[model samples]
Target: MSRRCELTGKAVLTGNLVSHSNRKTRRRFLPNLVNVTLTSDALQRSVKLRVSANALKSVDHRGGLDAFLIKASVDDLSPKAAELKRAVQKATASTAAAA
Candidate 1:
């Protein structure tokens, strides 16, 4: 349970918080991570993921979990999300081969 978005790989960023007196303090900028259940059309199942709000919007823009995973880079996805992407790819490939 780290503060990271499973889909987009968004993580806590370290930065300086400058005060009114021109003093700087260390601070963290965290992504807006939300627990969401997204449906995969290829797998025909719903998967739970902790994703950033921006990532969620991208998922919608890209067309759903399957499409998003298919288009996403493997380096950006978490282990679980990468696994799901593989599964979805396999499932879709199998269907395409059959047809």
Candidate 2:
């Protein structure tokens, strides 16, 4: 669909391309977006999302999908990701209550 990262909200940025003669032309800087299936330990399921390379690394650094989504900002997450985050939160809360 769109050229945007669902996790980090990384999108295409407009900039200038300078030639050898120092002439500037319009260009776009695209995010390195990739489709990945990340598993959520809280939800006990895997979800596929389009995310930037940096976001993928962040997810790994943070531990897993549920961990990353729990700490992620609502403004940066896409609609689908936000929904997933909510679901994970609910599941985690219920598990905490049960324990």
Estimate, for each residue in 27-96, the C-alpha lDDT of model 2 and write its tens digit: 9999999989999899888899999999999999999889999999999999999999999999999999
Clashing pairs in 1: none
Instruction: Judge candidate 1 at residue 43 and give its lDDT.
Output: 89
Which lDDT values do the candidates have, in the order given? 0.95, 0.95
For each candidate, what TM-score against the reference? 0.97, 0.97
Check candidate 2 and list the clashing pairs. Answer: none
- How many clashing residue pairs appear in each of the predictions shown? 0, 0
Question: Model 1 misses residue 14 by how many Å?
Answer: 0.6
Q: Write the per-residue lDDT of candidate 1 for residues 1-99, one digit (tens) a residue.
A: 899999999999999999999999999998999999999889888999999999999999998899999999999999999999999999999999999
